[model samples]
Target: MTNQIYPCLWFDGQAQAAAKFYCSIFKNSKITADNQMVVTFELNGKKFMGLNGGPHFKFNEAVSFVVDCDTQEEIDNYWSKLTADGGSEGTCGWLKDKFGVSWQIVPTVLPKLLSNPDKAQNVMQAYMKMKKFDIRELENA
Candidate 1:
């Protein structure tokens, strides 16, 4: 076994629910294990463990999962699923799920644009006005 530490999220008695919700959003995703206290799942090939710690602590924006999508459809799909059931939307394609876990549903081209010296400012301008990212607009800008 490798010594890498997979993210272990703390949920308020909703570990299973969170795991199921995450698995439903991504292709090739599934819950690998589950019990009364913990649920394990893979989201787009990444492993994560969720704990039903009974409302002791909550998720915050200090840490977040960034989904780099190749197309706008993928971004929209993830945004929709992750924001379901009392999740709140934030600026710049960021959102917090019902369990308060932060997510950035960003396009793959976003980093390219931001890294491009020629179009970086324009891309930033376009992104500044948006809630969910518009990949086409970012490309055009």
Candidate 2:
């Protein structure tokens, strides 16, 4: 037997809708299966399960999905889309989608920029005040 690990999200009677919404966002994603209670989907190849478990549980910032974007345009695209409708932005590339799911839209170059001892502070300072990450700003920092 093989062990497979994947995240299961809890939704308030919006499992299928959330799954479909996610599928529409990612380039290669689809809903594998959906029923009244559960929806299984793949986002860019990673499997996820969304459960229509009612309002008993809610998503919080404690757990979040991180999207690594290679360019500012990518970051901006994701930020704008994910923060649309009822979604809201948070500090440092964090945002809550319409379903209240937290996501972090980060630049792929962030790690390398933050790892540089000389500019680490500047990089940190620059990103700390940002809602969406800017690759150019990180590089300049």
| Cα TM-score per model | 0.94, 0.97
Off by over 4 Å in 2: none
- Best model number under TM-score: 2
Candidate 2 TM-score over all chains jointly: 0.97
User: 55-87, model 2: which lDDT tens digit per residue?
Assistant: 999999999999999888889888888888899
lDDT of 2: 0.91
Q: Once superposed on the true structure, which residue ranges of model 1 sit more than 4 Å away at CA?
A: none
Quote the lDDT for 54 in model 2. Answer: 89
The residue-level lDDT of candidate 1 at 62 comes to 93
Report residue 134 deviation for candidate 1 (angstroms).
0.2
In the order shown, the candidates' Cα RMSDs to the true structure are 1.1, 1.0
